[model samples]
Target chain A: MRNLSSRLSRWLISGPPLLYLLIFFAAPTLIMVFAAFRIPGDYGGLLPLLQTDDAGKTEVLINAGNWHDFITFENFGRFFEDSIYAELFLKSFWYAGITTLICIVLAYPLAWLIARSNKKTRDLLVLLVILPFWSNFLIRVYAWMIILGPQSYFSVALNHLLALVGIEPVSLLFSQFAVIIGLVYVHLPFMVLPLYANLEKHDMALLDAAQDLGANAWQRFWRITWPLSLPGVWAGTALVFIPALGMFAIPDLLGGTNSIMIGNLIKQQFLDSRDWPFGSVLSIMLTLSVLLMAAIAGWAGRSKKERA
Target chain B: MALLEIRDVVKTFGDFTAVNHVSLSVEAGEFFTLLGPSGCGKTTLLRMLAGFEQPNAGQILLDGKDMSQVPPEKRPVHTVFQSYALFPHMTVAQNIAFPLQMAGVAKADIPARVDEVLEDVRLQQFAKRLPHELSGGQRQRVAIARALVNRPRLLLLDEPLSALDAKLREEMQLELINLQKEVGITFVYVTHDQGEALALSHRIAVMNKGEVAQLDAPETIYSYPKNRFVADFIGQCNLLDAKVAEVGGSRMKLEIPGVGLCEALPVEGAQVGQSGTLTLRPEKIRLAAAVTHDADEVHFKGKVHDCLYLGDVTIYIVELENGTLVETMLPNSAPGRARFFDDNDAVELAWRFDAGHFLLG
Candidate 1:
């Protein structure tokens, strides 16, 4: 009886935060899933409908058919049949992969240079890398749009230069390339920081020993330095890839209609089309894909640890 | 001709000089040691020899060729770092074969050379283990095997045994000596342990303040140290301040105030009426129960301040009339031989005239 009282007291002390999470976070998500399967009116409003059973009595319905039309898998089939949705999904994956690869290539040398530099220079470089992150991310992405858009300062200057060269002015705004550039700009620091943290902890004595053992510069890097920094590489790539996969703001602002990604499609279904069922299905798929990627990355990390 | 010659090497980092105009020559196939305290430039000099660091002004000649501009990868030298610095990503066999692979040796021949070196270091069973899986001594052997597989003209060791415990360090030292003899490669070892240097080195160069104070055989360095620093650094010695009262062809008379006069051998630059310090080894001084024969030459009366009974020897800290404390060692010949001395026991200290070395400025 005494232990039970103490346990009850402990739970009472910790109950407020748990209650807050349940009311604010968990209840809203469950309500969203509940709303996703409700019957739709002509204007796509969720309204309860009546059903007549064998007893000749009318009853208000909240069944599977009212939610998702008797679980026919129609939402998934519709997603696959639509070329636009399929293309957007593929484009999102491709863009994220490209961004990750580019980030890795550009960040490795910068991180290596920072790690090898003297103390004062290393501090300056780190400050420069982190200075952009201090500003609001939306403000930073918007700044890129202004710089790269036509009639902006850079585009106007380029137009003048092209005129002098007897060439026609080119459109540099609302392109897929613009969105990729913005993604890379925002995520480059994420990649460089982790790589720098790992590379800085490396023992320089190993490099000298390798050279003394007759390894040239390239051989030393390939055989010793690169393999040792794999953990950082994996982490930095994941940091850039996961968020870039779901990015909507940059693609919506910088990309034209033809370059829309899966995130923009999901946004359209929810707000523009007011179709909650299809939107939920798309959200679930995207979340599952991301979770799958995370699981794979985690497995790889564990295997590397075991090998080490 | 010398296998390696350092001609007036001077290295400075900004304003701090690490090696101050040092010069030495090492013959081929010799085990030479540079012994000193930390920050004494022993490792710096060794690094310069290996071409890791270039001297501000000097020439390093190896095998009749100048190696001042030669990169470390191109030089015919290797180093076993104190940390072992083994490649963490590679197995033992792969590490031993790395240099051979880098040199573009045939793939078949590389394995044979790797096996040969692995056998030499007695690490054949550990050929497939990574560096992290091996013990400290085994990692050290792998480092040696890796360096030896390249067949470098010289091998440099920078306090390689310092990371190990006492017993493992002793074992590694003997192994290193045996390996050097078998490989017939010149070894330039750097260590601060006087005992290790004396044991493993054919000749030792004792360094102090970025300069070589004395370089000679172990016996000569221990007995005939050129300066007070070398005398104090090598072993325990009782240094006494004395004035040269009289000088002769082979011997001199020194006046040690409060301890009476003493006859000592004159160093090379002794002069009359000059104040100098005399060095006497602890083992050379003997303790007598009473005044004995030949006591007038060199003897002093003192009281035992403290006594330490080590397993092999009993150490006596004797206090003289001048309040100077002297430490002397007595061998324990029999089981009860050390029981005679106690704290505050009256004792007589005596040594021969030749045992005292007068240090001249």
Candidate 2:
């Protein structure tokens, strides 16, 4: 009897949080799946269709055609056949890849400097890096829009400078370059923070020991410092790459209508077109891409551990 | 000519001085140790010699060259840190071969040199293991091999055996002594352990605060310390406050309160009525059943307070008449013959006139 009460108490303690997740998160996802196949009625809610037996007795009915009627492959077939969608997907991948590379190159020296600097200087630099996040992310991205807009302060200044060299004013606003720049600026802190956290804990004596053994500056860094800090590099790469892939606001505001990424397509399907089924399919595909990237990262980590 | 010379070297961190105006010259192929307690600046002085730290006001000459401006990496000297500072990512052989590889030595020569150093340090079989995989003694050997592989003119060790257990520390001390003998390189070792310093070093420089208290051979430093600090630091010594009563040829009569006048060696420039301390080693004071010898000048009657029976010797803590405690070591013989002195047993303490040295301060 006592054992039963203990088991009941344990169940009661854990039941509320699990039930909350199931109702608020899991239930909505399940309902979305069900609603994707439901037949449309006069209103948005699905209504039951009636059927009569051979005796002609009236009875409440459930229609199986609600699940089977929408057999048209129009959405999936269109997404695959259209070259625009394919191009957008490929462009998103390349943009995220380039942003990740730039973040790695830039954040490495920044993180190293922060890790090796004196305490007061390091704290000040870290504060400056994170100060942008104090305001709303959307507001920060919008600030970039003002800087790159035509006839804006930067554009006017650059145009005057170029006119002196007998050149035309460069159009940088609403371009893919603007979107890439916005992504790099917004995600740089994410890359630097993790890299600094890992690099700060490195044993600096290892470098000194290497130098004592006749290793010059370059040899010491390549053979000792870099290999010891590989984990931080991998962590920084993942932190920058994953979020840049799904970035929506920066591309929309900076790239304007020309830069339509996968995130923009998903947003348009759900809100603009009101096609929840296709939106759900696209959402699932984006999630799968993230999962695949995570799996590859995990594999790389495992191999590194094995080699060590 | 000396292999290393540090002339009037002083290091200051802001207003606080770490190494004062100190000067010393070390001969080639000599094992010299800097012996001091923590914060005494022995390590700081060693670092200056290694070119890791530059003195604020001094000059360091290495092999007749002024090396005060040279950096640690460009210098021909290496240091073995107390932590071993072994590269965690490199194997034992690779760790030792790093210096040679950095010098752009031939790839074929690197392996053989590594093997030679490993064999010299008796760690040839564990060449492929990482530092963390080896025992503390083995890791220490690897660190030594790594430093010696570079063929440096001078090797500096900063309390290298401080991180080991007692047994391992002893074994490593002997090994280090032998290694120094074999290599014939100038060794500047830093440690706080007096026994380690005495055993391994040809000469020792005892440091106090930011200055060298005394620098001499091991026996001279132990037998004839220059001051109260050296006398108290080197070994257990009884320091009695006294004043000079009379001065003779090489001896002086000191009048100690609560104890009668005693004869002690007259230190240089000591005069009558000068305040000083009479320093006597514990082993130098003899305990007997009665005053058997007429030549014994300073004698005291005391009662034994405690007795400890060690394997080879027994120590008796005798409480003198003036309520001061004195310890005397007696060798153990066949059972009761050596056990005559016990707690509360009365005994007489006496020493020769030359056993006690007078310290001015």
Candidate 3:
């Protein structure tokens, strides 16, 4: 009787989250995978799988006799047929890669400083890193818009400095640079949090040992700190890169027309062009690519462990 | 010239002084120890020697070179931390090779040297294993091997054996002695364990409140401590509160509170009718039910109050007539579980005339 109660409690605790994920996340993903193989409707969404004759009799139209009418592979074919889609995917990868690298470079020192600070100030610094979440994300992007605008003081100062060297005044707003800045700004906390957690658990004695064994400052960091903090780096990469790769809002606001990424194309396929099947195909490919990257990272980490 | 010398070094953290005007010199190829309790400035002294902490007003001359300007990286010294501090990500071999790689030793010689040190520590078969994969003793050996791989002029060990269990600690103590003899490097060790210091050091400096209370050979420090602190800190002792009644050369008569006048060795500049303490070891007392008389011995009478039965030795706490407790240790070598004395049994205690050392206020 006690075992039964314990088992019931276990299920009761886990049931809500399981049901929610199955209904919201897993069901939509399965439906999208099925949609990627279907034909586009005359107006929008997927084609109907049933039809009625003139005699008012209902019949199924998705069988082998008329399978081509409802079921199709052309949506998947179109993604491969057009090189433009492939180029857009490449552009998105490049943007996400740069954002992740820059985030690591910027967040590492901040995280280290927070980890090394005394207990009284450490909580305050971590709270400051997370304070951006309190305000609306869209509002933060708009704030960036003002900061990088053509008439803002920052851009004016940069242009003035460029004029002194006989260089052309450059536009900071609605450019690739603006897009990168927005992406990095939005995802920096994700990088900092995980890196801080990893750095905080590190033993300070290791650095002393390294130094006592004749390691200079740079060598100590490169040899000891960097290698030990790889797990955090990878975790931060996943948190930032996955979301940045599928981002459309930043590109829509700051990219103008020259920097439209794959995310922008996917949004346009479903909403503007009214092609849900093709959109599903692009979304599925993005998911697959992310899974492949995760697999490669896992394999690399495991192999290193085995070697050690 | 000494291999390592500190000329009046002082370290302070704001209002608190960690190491205060400490000066000492260590000879080359000697096993020296800084012994103290927690926060007694021994660690601070070791840090100064390792170049981790700079002295506010002093110079550290290592091998006749002023080490004030050199950083920890440039100093020819390495430390085995109490926690071992082995890099978790690196294998045993890689951990040992880190020093060689940082020193820019010839790339070709790095592997051989790492392997050699690993073999010396008897960890060759575990080279490919990570630090967490090994036991605590193995990890300690790895830390030692890593520090000794490049053979720095001096090796500093900051209470490296304090983390192990009692059995493992004794085993490692013997191993440390053997390893030091094999390496022949000048060692500067710091620990709060007085027994460990006594067992390993050729010379010991006992510190108290950021200053050295006594510095001498281990035998002298143990047998004739310069002050009450060193005598009390090193081993179990019976300190009798006494006053000097008369002084004659190195011998003096001390009138203890309950045991009457006793003979002991006087401190320098000993004056008659001054307050002092008579420190005597428990093992030095000749304890028995009734004893034969010696020519130059002080005899006393007491009743056994309590007894502790350890495997090799048993301690008998005897209460004198005036309510003073004195402990005397006897070996339990009679091949059975029988103890020497029972509680409330009257016993006799005696020691030689100059066996007790006296410290004056």
Candidate 4:
């Protein structure tokens, strides 16, 4: 009797949350996957045709002929057949890759400074890095919009300097550079936090030892510091890259018409084009690629551990 | 000329003085140890030698060249840190080759030199393994090998054996001595363990409060410590407060409170009727129930206050007539050997007249 009560208590603690996930998350994902394999309705809805059973009773059943259409890979076939989707996919990867690179370049020196600072200074710097999270992310992005706008103070001053140099006045917003700047600005802390945590635990005495053994500052950094902090580098890269790939708001707010990424294309398919099956197909592809990236990262981390 | 001359070096961090006006000269090919307790600034001196730290005043001369402006990499020095500080990502061979690589040894020549040093440390079989894969002793050898690989003029060891277990520390102590001799590099070692210092050093500078309290050969430092700090820090010692009764040639007679008139070596500036202290090592004093009279020895009567049976030796805490406590060590020789003196046993202890070194109070 006690065993039954204990089991009931365990279930009571976990069962509701698990059931909620099943209904809210798993159910929608399962439906979306099933819908990806079917043809869209005339009005872009996913209502399967109802049918009656041979038993003298009416039943709500999916049309079996739709399976034949799914087997033909109609949605996937159309997605691959379109070159614009392929171009958008590549463009998304390029933007995400460049953003991750820029974030790494900017975060490393800042993270090193934080790690090397005294305790009080370190706490204040880390707080400054995290202070932005207290403000609304969308509002922060909008703020960047004003700062980078063509007629804004920064751009106007930049244009004056260009005019002094006899160069053309450059438009700072609604460009690829603006999109990259937005992505880097948003994702920098994601990179810095992990790198700082890793570098903070680094044995500084190793640098001293290296120096005593005839290593210059640059050699010590390249040989001792950089290689040891690879795990954090990879972690920060994933944190920046995965989200940047599917980011919609930053590109929509700052990028030009030429900057339409896979995320924008997918949004257009589901809403404007009313192509539910194609949107589901793109979402599945994105999810698979992310899982693959995570798997590769895990393997790299494991290999590094084995080598160490 | 000495290989390294540290002339009146001082280091201060804010208001705290870490190494204060310390000066020493280390000869080439000597195993010199800076022996002290923790926070005694021995490691700071060693760090300054390695050029990791700069003295606020005074200068360090390596091979008669002033190293004030030279950075650690350019200086002809290397250090083995207490933590070993071997690169965790590098293999044992790679760790050993680090110094050579930093010195710009050619890639083709690196592996052979690494192998040679690895063999010197007797870690040839573990070359492919990472530092985390090795044992404590093995990692220590790797650190040592890494430091020695470049053939630096001086090798500074900052309490490298402090991390090892007792047995491993002893074994590494002997290995380090042999390695120092083989390399023939002037070594500046720092350690809190007095036994490690005595076992390894040709000469020891006993540091106290950021200054060298006494610097001498191990035997001289052990036998005739210049001050109470060195005597107490080096080993088990019994200090007895005494008043000088008379001063003769090379010796003085002291009136010890517990033992009455005792003859001691006259330290410089010891005058008659002035109060002083006598330092006697526990091992130097012999205890017996009855003893033959010797002119060269001084004897005192006491009772055994406590007897401790440590495996190799038995310690007897003897209470002298005037209530001064003196500890004496008697060798056990063999296991289960009976002790001569037990608790409350009346005994007479004698030591050589020169055994009691006089120190100013």
Candidate 5:
């Protein structure tokens, strides 16, 4: 009786969260997945395949034929054959990969500086990294537009400087490079926070011991600091890459017509072409790819811990 | 020439002085200890020798070369840190081979060298295990082996055995002594535990507030401390305020207010009527039922205030007439356990004339 009561109490504590997830997240996800398989009606709704007659009235109902049609891979086939989805997928991955690499290159030294700084300077740097989040993200993207635009202060000053050097004025706004810069700027904090957390917890005495054991600065970093900080690097890379993969606003605001990423393609399928089934298929594929990335990262972290 | 010469080294952290004008010379194969309490700057001095922290005012010469401009990696010294700072990602053998690999030894010879070090520390069976997988004592052994593998001329150990339990600490202290003898390398050891310093070191420099209070062998430090701090720090000592009644060469008679006259070996700067402290070790005093008149021994009459039986020794707190307390330790060498004197028992204590050391400062 006591054991049963204890188990009952434990379930009581955990029951609400489980029910909330089922209602809010799992239910909606199930509906979207079911919709992905079904045939679309005239206005992006599921087709009613059942009919009923009661008294003198006839009513539409779910049909078994619609369920059979829903199970077929026709929408998936149309998505792959009609659209340049493979190219978009590769380009999205390429952009995200480059952005993640750049974030790491920039974030590592920044995190190290903050981690090794005195109390006041460390707090200031950390605050600077987080301060961008207080402002609206869309506004921040617009600010980048002004800074990179042709008639802006930066372009004006650069054109003047170029005239002195006998070079032509250049355009930087509405390019792939601009999108990358926007992505790196917005997602930099995500990479810096995790890396700083890991680096801050490191014992400085280890470095001294390594140096005392005849490792110079370069060897000390490669042998001791780099290997030890790998978990942080991997974590930061994942944090930046996952969001950068399907980012829409940055590419829409800064990228030109040639720079349409996978996210814009998905958005257009749903809103522009009203192809709900194709959009759902694309969404499912992206979700699966993200899950794969997470699984790989988890495996890498686990093996590293086991080896340690 | 000494293997290591520290000449008037001074280290200041901002406004506070950590090591102030410290100077010493360590012989090539001597196990010299810098013994003091925490914040006394012994570790700071050791760090200066290791070239981790530079002294602002002086130079550290290793093998007659000034090490002020040298980085830690360039210096021929290794340190066993207090935390045992073993690389968590590396196995025992890999950690031991780190120094050798950095020194550019041939890759083929690294394994054999690591094996030799593992054998020396008796961790050969567990060389493949990571640092976290080993016990505390095992980790400490790996740390020692890692340093010794370098075969540096000087090894600096900063309170290496402090993390171990009492029994393990005692065991490791003896092991370290033996290891030092076998390797025949100068070890600049730093610790706050006076007993550990006395047991393991060939010479101890007892530091007090960034200054060396006394530097001598363990026996001399115990029997003849140079000042009140050295006397009080090393072991349990009873210090009585006294005025020098008469001084003749090295011996002097002191008039202690509560205990009356006591004979002590006054330091060289002792003068007549000079106010000083007389230090008497607890174990040197003997207790008896009645006063046994001996020409060489000074006797005192007191009543026992407390008696503590600690298996191998019994400590008695004896109170003099003016309520001054004196502690006397009697070893329990007898086969059977018995209490010698109970509370409030009248007793007489006696010690040799030369047993007390009179500190002028």
Candidate 6:
């Protein structure tokens, strides 16, 4: 009776979430992976794998004699056949990399300031960082769009200054610059929160020890503070890079013709072009790349721990 | 000439003065200690010596050079912080080699010096270990080695052993004494633990408030405290309120209100009819069931009020005929349970004529 009760209790603890993920998440992902290798029907979705004759006996439509009856690798081949898909992925990586760098550069000083503040002020600053999440993300992006548009006061003043400096006046909205600004603005809090958590735990006595041991201010920061904060840096990098790499909405709203990334193309293939098999193939590749990136980061972090 | 000197140093934060007009000099190769309770400005004064903070109204001279505008990094001094502040990211050897690297020592000479100091502290086998990998005592030794690797003229230690357990603290105290002797670097140590200060220091400056109450050798500070503050702070002492009835040379007669006349060694400027306290140590007084007292001893008739057995020694609280309680400690030299006195037992408490020192108000 005791053993049965213990087993029942364990099941009760893990039953709901396990069942929910299996039904909602795991099932859909497996279907998508299977669809990636199937042939597209005349309409949109995957072709039927089984067919029924007039006599009410079902027969498999899959045939090794016919290449494209039910299943094929044609969707994956189309992706590699067109160099446009590879270039789009490279562009997305570049945009995400730049956004991550800019977020770090802007977030570090803000995090340090917040971490060093007194208790009451530190709470208020951290609240301000998280307050952006309370509102609709689309509404925040739309607000940036208004600010970056040509007729807005900010863009007019910026272009006026550029004209005065002997440079040509330029449009700010619907450009790569606008897309980058939007990406960094949305992802900045991810970098600051982890960096702040790490910096807050540091002991000030270590800096005093460094200074007492004949290190200048710059040397103390470079040798002591910077090296100690690497774990936070890596965490912030992963948080910002993963989302920025997969983002589509910012580029859709703010990017020009040349700035469209792989996310935009994947959305077009699924909804506008009605190419479900091609879309599934693109999604699988995207998922694999994200997983590969996470694996590399985890490996790097573990190796660093072992050596350090 | 002294190796380091401070003249009228004062440090203030807003309206509160942390170190007020403190002045002292440390000799070369001397182990000097600043002993005080918390917030007595011992740490503040030590920070000034290390050039971490500048004095508000005085000059600090190190090696006869004025150090007013010098920053901490420029000063030829280092500190072993209380928390053992060894860099967590650096290994034991890297932590010790930090100062040498910062000082721009040649790359070839760095490894040899770091290894030597590691061997000196007997942590050669754990040179590749991180600070968190070591025990508390090992981390402490790493901190010391890191500070001493550069061989500065002065080393400041701020309660470096307070984080250890009692046994470990005692062991580290002895190690600290030996390290100081071997390095021959002038040490300016600060701690609030009086026993630690007494055991390690050549000279101790007992501080109260933001000022030095007394500066003397360990023996002198323990046996001949100059004031009620210094007397009470260093160890357990009984201060009996007394009035000087007769003053003569180095000896004076004091009238304890109900205990009648007793003689005590006088502080300077003792006069007749002056009121003061007689600071008497616990071990100086003798407690027994019966006593054949000498003429040079002041004797009292009392009842044993309570007793505490402390393995090595036991302290007895005796209530005199006048209702004043006095404590006396005796060695537990016997092999058995070492309980000498019990409650409500009639006893005699006696001390030599000069056992107590009188501090006038």
Model 2 residue A179 CA deviation (Å) reads 1.0
Ranking by lDDT: 3, 6, 5, 4, 1, 2
lDDT of 4 by residue, A1-308 (tens): 99999999999999999999999999998988877877777788664556466886675554575457433478888888988777788889999999999999999999999999999999999999999999998999999999999879999999999999999999999899999999999999999999999999999888988888888889999999999999899889988999999998888899988886778878888998888888999988887878887898789879976875
The digit string of per-residue lDDT tens for model 2 on B147-172 reads 99878999989899999999999999
Q: What DockQ does every candidate get? A: 0.69, 0.54, 0.88, 0.83, 0.79, 0.87
Candidate 5 residue A109 Cα shift, in angstroms, is 2.5
Clashing pairs for model 2 are: none
Fraction of the reference Cα-Cα interface contacts (below 8 Å) that each candidate reproduces? 0.84, 0.68, 0.97, 0.95, 0.95, 0.97
Best by DockQ: 3
- C-alpha lDDT of candidate 4 relative to the true structure: 0.89
Chain A TM-scores of each predicted structure, in the order given, are: 0.77, 0.79, 0.94, 0.86, 0.86, 0.90
Residue B361 C-alpha lDDT in model 5: 47
lDDT of 5 by residue, A16-118 (tens): 9999999998998777776677676667555545545676566645456545754557777876796578788889988999999999999999999999999
Predictions ranked by DockQ, top down?
Answer: 3, 6, 4, 5, 1, 2
Residue pairs of candidate 4 with colliding backbone atoms: none
How do the residues B304-343 of candidate 1 rate in per-residue lDDT, one tens digit apiece?
9998888798889899899988889889987667656788
Which TM-score values does chain B get in all models? 0.96, 0.94, 0.97, 0.97, 0.97, 0.98
Top candidate, metric TM-score? 3
lDDT for A70 in candidate 4 is 35
Please state the Cα-based DockQ of model 1 relative to the true two-chain complex.
0.69
- Give a tens-digit lDDT track for model 6, residues B1-361: 9999989999998998999888999999999999999999999999998888889998999999999988999899999999999999999999999999999999999999999999889899999998999999999999999999999999999999999999999998899899999989999999999999999999999998889999999999988888999999999999888899997776779999888898777667878999998989999998889988998899888998889888899999888878888989889997885888789999988899888888888
Going through the candidates in the order shown, the clash numbers are 1, 0, 0, 0, 4, 0
Q: How much is A89 displaced in model 1, in angstroms? A: 2.3
Candidate 1's C-alpha runs over 4 A off are A1-42, A45-68, A116-127, A160-168, A292-308, B243-266, B269-271, B291-297, B321-323
Pull out the clashing pairs in model 5. Answer: A49-A63, A50-A61, A50-A62, A50-A63
